[model samples]
Target: MTLTPTKLSKSEKTRQAILEAAQTLFYEKGYDGASVRQIAEAVPIDPAMIMRYFGSKEGLFSAAALVDLRLPDLGSIPRDLAGKGLVRHFLMLWEGDRSGIGLPILLRSAVSNQNVADKIHEVFEEQVVPAISGLVPEGEEDSCAGLIVSQLFGLALCRYILRLSPVAEMTEQEIVERIGAVIQFHLDAARDTAGSNRP
Candidate 1:
C-alpha cells in the first residue's frame, strides 16, 4: 500500500498566494494604496502573471474580496427575535477576526473607490436581499434589506471604523440589544405597512 498527498496545481497555488497577499495588502494599505505590483512583490512573482491570472486590478480585487454573508437561517429563530439573532451573528462577524476580511476590506476601500462601492452594492443585492426576503413583506424585501444594511453598516462605521466614543465602548450585548431592535423595527414596519390595508 502507498499513500501520496494530493498537490494543488502550480496555477492554483499561485492564485491562492496572490489572494493572500492581496487581502493583507488591501487591509493594510487600502485599495488605492495597495498596487498590483505590491501584491506581486509580496508573492515574489512576476507582476505580469497577476494580470494573466486575474485580468485586471479590479478583477483581482473582486476575486479577493468575495464575501459570503454567512447569514443565519431565520427559520430557527423565533419570528419576533430573528432580528436579534441576525444582529448578534453580524456583531460577531464585525467584531471578531471576520472584521479583518471581506466586510471591512470592502468598506474601507469603498469609501474612496467607486469600483469597490459598486462591489459592496452588488454584495447587498446578492447576499443581503435574499437573507431578508423571508423576514419582511413580500414586495418590500429590498427596502427592508436596505434599512437593515444601513443600520448594521452605520454601526460598524461608527464603532469600528470611526472609533467614536460611546459607540466604540458599547459592549456586544448593548450592540445586539440596540442594533437588533432597529433591525426588528425595520422588519416590523414592513409587515405592519403591508397589513395596514388603508385605502
Candidate 2:
C-alpha cells in the first residue's frame, strides 16, 4: 500500500492562486493600484473569474487581506504581565522585514484605504479587546486595548514602515521592554482607575 496526498479541487486551487497573487499585488501596488484584471493575469485565469469568485476587487482584497491577530490568551497570563505579553506578541509579529505578515501590508494600505483601516479595527476589536477583557477592570477593556493598538501601530509605522532612526535600530528585546512597559501601563492604569472608583 502506498500513501497518497489529498488534492485540492480546481476551484480551491484557483482561489488560493488568487489570494497569493492578490497579496503580492496589494503589497506592491496598494489597494487602489492593484486591480482585478492584474490579479487575474497573475493567476493566468480569465478576468471574469475574479469577479465570479470574489464579486469585485474590494471583495477579493477583503478575502485576500484577512489577518488573524492570533493574540495570546491573556486569561491564563499573570495579571501584572499581561500588557507586556501583549506588546511582546505584537513585536514578534512586526518582527523581521515583515515580508510575509499580512499586518504590515494591511497597515500600509490602511493609511490610504478606508476599507483596509476598517478591517484592522474590526480585527483588533474582535480579537485584541476580548483577549484582555479579564485582565483589565470592568469597562476598561475597550479603552485600554485602543491605547495599546495605537502605540503598537505607531511603532510599526516608524520602525518598520518608515524605518525611522533609532527606532529601527533598537533590538527586539529593547522594543519589548520599552513598548511593553507602555502596554503594561495601559493595563495597570485601567485596573488602577477601577480600583480608585470602587471606594
Candidate 3:
C-alpha cells in the first residue's frame, strides 16, 4: 500500500501526540508512577495504540525523556574559551527553554527512576561526550566527559532542583565565570598530566 503524504503526516502527528502526552504524564507522575493507561488517557488514545507505537511503557518513558544537548562543536570553539562556551550554551538551554521539557524534567525523573537515569546517562554518552571528545587529550576522553557531566548535572540540581540560595541567585555571568573555570580545569588537566604518572 502506498502511503501518501497526508497519511504520513497524520501518523507523525499521532506519534507526536503520544510523546507529548507521555512527557507530561511522566513529568507529573514519574516513570513508575505513570502508567500506560494513564498515558493513553492523556493522549486520549487507546492503550493498545500506545503499545503499538512505543512497544511498552518502558519504551514510552524512554522516548519521553529523550533530550538533545545540542552541544556546540568543540573544534569550532577556541580551546582557551571552550569551557566558557559550553557553560554558556548549557545555561542558555536551561534558561531559554520554553517547552518546559528540558534537562530539568529529565533530571527530576532520573533521581527516582533507574530507567530514566540510564536514559540520561545514554544521552550524555551519546551527545555530550562526542562533542568534547576531540577537545580532551587522547586517553582522557572518558574521565573528562564524566567530570563535565558531574559538574553540569550538579549545577542543574543545585540551581533548579534544590534551589540553593547561592547557586540559584548567582547571575548567569557569575555562573559562567565561576563554573566555567572549573570546567576548563577538567578539560586542561588531562593535557597537563598527559605524559606524567601520578602516584
Candidate 4:
C-alpha cells in the first residue's frame, strides 16, 4: 500500500507558529523588550524549539521580517511630477502600520548586524535606485540615485521612525510639495555634473 505524506509537517507548523507569535509580541512590545520565552509561550511551545529552528532571536527576526515595497513604475510617471509621485508613493507605503512592519524591524536590526546592513543596501540598490533612475540621465545614474535615496530615507527616519512632530503632522500633499522640489533639484544637479565630466 502507498501512503501520501502530509502537506505540512508538524515541525513546520510549529515553526510557523513560533514566528507568528514572535511577530505579534515584537509588534506590541519593541524588539528589545520581547523575550524568547514570551514568543514561545504565545505558541504554547518550548523556547528551545525556536533556538533549534532559527538559531537565535536575531536569526528568527531576520527570517520573519520581510517586506514588499510595491514601488510604482518610474517610466509611466509624468516628467514634471516624478518628484511628487516618489514622495507620495513612499509615504503611502510607510503610513500604514500593517504594510510597514518590516521597515521598523529592519531599521532597528541594521544598527548591529552586517548581514542586515547588506540586506538594506540590496533593498536600496534594487528597489529605490531603479525607480528613480528613469528620472535622471543615463550616465549620472549612480550618483543621482545615491543622493535621492539618502534624502528620501532621511525623510522616512524623521517622519516615521523618529516620529518628529512637525514632520509627522504635515499633510501628505504638503510633504510631497516640500521634499519633492529638493529631490528634483538634486537629480538635475547630478545630470549636469555627469555632463560636465564627459569628453
Candidate 5:
C-alpha cells in the first residue's frame, strides 16, 4: 500500500486550525469571554488539543497576541527631530491596525490579569522602552518613558477603545501634532538631564 500525499502534516494542520478558531473566537467574544472548549468547538477539535499544542490558555493568548509591532528604527530618527519622528511612527502604528483586536484585548487584560499585565510590561520593557532608552539615556529614561507611555496608552484607550467622539475623529496628523509637543517636552527634559549628569 502507498501512502497518500497530504497538504499539511497532521500537527501543522491541527495548529493552524486551532489558531484560526482561536482568532475568530477571541475577536468575537474577547479573550476573557472566550474559552478553550468554544475554540475547540469552532475548530471541531478535541478540547485537550488546545492544551496539547499551546500548553495553556495564556500561551494561546500570547501566541495570538503576536503582531508585527511595526516601528521605525529609533537610531535612524534624527537627534534633533526624534520627537516628530516618534510621533509619526506612533500614529502609523496605531492607525495601520485600528480594527485589530490585539490592542483591545491587551488594554482590557492589563487592568485585570497578571499574565496580560506581564505581557504589556514585557512589550514596553523589551521593545518600546529599550528603543526610547537608546534615544534618551539611562538616568532620565524612565521619566521620559513613563510619561510618554502614559499619554500614548491613554490616547489609545480613549480614542480607539472607548470611541470618544471628536477626539477619535480627529485626523492622525492633528492628533499627532497635538500630542507631539508634550512628548517632545518629556524627551527634551530627559536630554537636558542626561547632558547635565555627564561629568
Candidate 6:
C-alpha cells in the first residue's frame, strides 16, 4: 500500500507473476478449469495474495485479458494494401511471438466461457471498429468490423486451435497472401455498398 520504491517494485513483480501464472492456466484449462488455487500454486503465492491483488477470479481474468492488438494506423497504410497490412500484422502477432500469452489465452478461454467470449467481443468492438470506421461506409462500420473479425479470428482458430492441415502448415506469408486478399475484398465491398446506398 505504501508508495516506497522498493515496495512498489516488489508489488509489481508479484502482480505480474500472478498474471503470468493465471494466463498459463487459463490457456491450458480455460476459465472454468483454471481455479484460483491452481493459479496460486503456479505462482507459488497464497490464494489470499491473489485476492489481495485482483479481488476475484473475474477481476483477475479481466486484468489478464488485456491485450493491445497494436493494429496499424490504417490512414498511414496504402489504401490498396490496408488489408494486407492488417492481416500481416495479425499473422505476425500470432506466429511471431511464442512467448506471448495474451491472445492465445483469450482465444482458448473464450471457447467455453461466456465471460471470456463477451470480453473478446467487447475488445474488438471497441478497438477494431473505431480503427477502420473511417474507411467503411457510414452506418456500415459495425457489420464491416464483424466481417473483418470473423476472417481474422477464423484463420486463427483453424490454424492455431483446430490445427487444420493446410492452414496449420502454411507459412505466414502464404496466409498473408491468401487471407489478405479476402480481407481486402471485404473492405472494398463495404465501401462500394456504402457508395451505392448513398442518395
Candidate 3, 1-199: lDDT as tens digits: 1235456677788888898888777777677788899888988999999989999887787677768777878898789898898899888877875343646668888888786788787888798878888887677788888998799889988997789999999999999999999999999996777657543
- Per-residue lDDT of 26-74 in model 6, one digit per residue for the tens? 8788888899999999999999999999999999987876777887889
The alpha-carbon deviation from the true structure for residue 3 of candidate 1, after best TM-score superposition, in angstroms, is 20
Q: What is candidate 1's CA lDDT for residue 161?
A: 85
- lDDT for 128 in candidate 5 is 73
Candidate 1 similarity to native, TM-score: 0.86
Q: Roughly what TM-score does model 3 have, to 2 decimal places?
A: 0.82
Can you give the lDDT of residue 33 in candidate 3?
81
Where model 4 places Cα greater than 4 Å from the true spot, the runs are: 1-17, 24-34, 42-45, 51-58
Cα lDDT computed for each candidate against the true fold? 0.85, 0.82, 0.82, 0.76, 0.75, 0.85
Error of 3 at 48 (Å): 3.3
Candidate 6 vs. true structure, TM-score: 0.90
Tens digits of lDDT, candidate 2, 141-170 = 899888888899999989978899899999
Candidate 5 clash pair list = none
- Supply candidate 5's per-residue lDDT for 196: 87
| C-alpha TM-score for every candidate | 0.86, 0.86, 0.82, 0.76, 0.78, 0.90
Task: Summing lDDT over every window of 10 consecutive residues in candidate 6, give the lowest-scoring window.
Answer: 1-10
Candidate 1 lDDT, tens digit per residue, 30-139? 89999999999999899999999999998888877877778888867788998889888887776666333778789888999998999899989988899888887788
CA error at residue 171 for candidate 6, angstroms? 0.5
Clash pairs, model 2 backbone? none
Root-mean-square deviation per candidate: 4.0, 3.8, 4.2, 5.6, 5.3, 3.5
Q: Which prediction has more favorable lDDT, 2 or 4?
A: 2
Cα RMSD (Å) between model 6 and the true structure? 3.5
lDDT of 1 at 155: 90
